[model samples]
Target: MASAPQAQGLPLFYNDLQPLSSDLHANYKIRRAETAPFLAKQHAVPLTVEEFPLVQRYLPIVFSMGDEPVPLGLMGLNEGINVFFDADGKFRENEPFYIPAYIRRYPYMLARLRPDAEELSLCFDPTSDSIGDFEEGEALFEDGKPSELVQQVLKFNEDFEIAGQKTNAFMKELKELGLLMDGEVSIQPDGAAQPYIYRGFQMIDENKLNEMRGDQLRKIVQNGMLPLIYAHLFSLNLMREIFGRQMQQGAVAQQEQPAA
Candidate 1:
């Protein structure tokens, strides 16, 4: 099976992929995450296009830099800092954050059987603590067949895969239309002397949209791309909110630290 899409310090703890089979994994149980401490260090998390509306209300969404530009929800602006997660990787301040399905589909990923093969197999990261050796959690298999829980995970993965395809296609169309361009954002916090300048990203060029031919605009609208583009633009405001959250949290952390 194709390995988890590799990136530097990304897709955390998903190493040593093993294709799910009844023989080897029948006894395997996954420990339900009581806390999301794993997410504490993450700033950006992969997001599906379908999640734009829900996520926009909570966090700014951006495109990851690469040939395949995956949609990413900006959990924090700086590296190794996620404002959404607390010290224990749980939600901060007991506030409700829209958990992206991508994060929810942790440990298990639908990987391709072969490079050229269209078929996909359910795979899990054996290294994850979520995958358990204990008999208390839900079983991966029962009667030598995938259990109900396994089927649910599989369905979730399948839906994720389908959404991924749609996002890819949308990105491809954006590229073809030359609508996406290099993006940057600058944020100046209340007490910071220097503004934080973020670069090396992609965003829809509104100027280009303004210059677009009427027919082209209609075509994009027909493709159901307009709302998504607007959603992204509208969500940019939340970046400042995220920065405020970060500063507030940073202060709290510093206050809690024992002085040298």
Candidate 2:
């Protein structure tokens, strides 16, 4: 298994409006892998005693086209993980983080370019109990109408490669802009042949980050963080704009504020 720090080095990180030294990139990757899982477990389903080891052993690879292994941290493989916010934090999970469009298309891509591999599976954590259903919030990338949010994220990832960026700086920008949000993943255990839910960090709002100030935000923008941050920001902004507009129009007058 790759050590946490070793794994992070594979992904590039931007800093000071320029990509950071290779050494710094390595540090961020390790940090992400070590920290992300703890966050995922917060929103994941509770693991039964028997399932603990499987959950612990499996680590999640946060998806980003720019960074080969975008380590958004780690998550348990089984149910009972979740996302949380410190009392002083600025964001909250208003809704479950839906799977991205690119991920949905991966199964087909794998089938078309079948490779000799030991094993392959899609690991995710679903926020809602209705794990079997993907009717709503399903992202389909076809006919040039890929999920708008995902498209933006992919672009941001590409920029990271073009410009060279660092990881910690990118995350700092994400937090400052409020683009990062709680996310969920559903994983299929090695032998069970069944899918299970686990929770983790995800990109929610995009535009809110536009309000952020200072060179820190600029550094993140210059780095590859643009794609992930923008995707999350757009998603959250879209939801809020739609819902907020609906409420103003009296579409759902009795709705209550989301729980923190």
Candidate 3:
């Protein structure tokens, strides 16, 4: 669900990558996306700690299941199911949903040019129609130099990279403290005979959180990490909301099936 082939694993929504340069893409223009076809089938997206408060209000924030767990914003409880968006990647309802910066930064990201490269380079997905030679759109370069728009885009990606670093640090702390645990959520519709159980994800263990030493709790609070943790915990209720939406969209039927 992430990206196309690359020597280093590419992030989400990119089919191909090429370093942005005045020499190679001098005539290129960055166009605004009318619809995100790449996001149509993506149910979950990588999330940074910075977005926790805002993202919590709409999507259930959970951690991906693995030895190295990363935060994810759930668009749907199950794979290949995105209730918030339609087949064209447009919002299904008039109610606003917080679009994660990870999604907004699609087609462009900072990546190492080589495995041993010390510095990251501004690279873009060449397959994206958003960045290409076009008669109408914001110019990527002016007078053989990067335009103001390109600089702004670069700044956004740089900020995202910083946020990613913070997220990694946060995850490391959680792991060290032994806070995250395999998560499971079960929902039983009013008339359903069996409850649909969702699993294969990670979440903060509330039992462990409640039993933490005062000093450990204070450390996270002092660093403003407490609220972010709560945001993720509070957002878990939205799983049922998303499930309801799936039913309304006909993605889920009356029949019981395992959800993972």
Which model scores highest in TM-score? 3
lDDT of 3 by residue, 1-260 (tens): 21111224566677788999999999999878877888777888889999999999999999887678889898887777888887997777787779999988878899899989999999999898788999999999999999998899899999999999999999999999899998899899998879988887889999999999999999999988889999999999999998998998888744555686
Cα deviation at 19, candidate 3, in Å, is 0.1
For candidate 2, lDDT tens digit of each residue in 44-152? 2211112222322232333221222233322222223222322222123465443322222211111111246543222122221212234444342334344454455
Q: Clash pairs of candidate 1?
A: 36-89, 37-89
Error of 2 at 31 (Å): 27
For model 1, how does the per-residue alpha-carbon lDDT over 92-125 read when each residue is reduced to its tens digit? 6666668998789888888876779788999887
After TM-score superposition, what is the CA distance of residue 129 in candidate 3 from its true location, in Å?
A: 1.6
Query: What TM-score would every model get versus the actual structure?
Result: 0.88, 0.23, 0.94
Candidate 2 vs candidate 3: which has greater TM-score? 3
In model 3, pairs of residues that clash are none
Whole-model alpha-carbon lDDT for candidate 1: 0.78
Name the regions of candidate 2 deviating beyond 4 angstroms: 1-70, 73-76, 79-165, 186-195, 202-223, 228-260
Residue 108 error, candidate 1, Å? 0.4
Candidate 1: where is the Cα deviation over 4 Å? 1-13, 191-194, 251-260
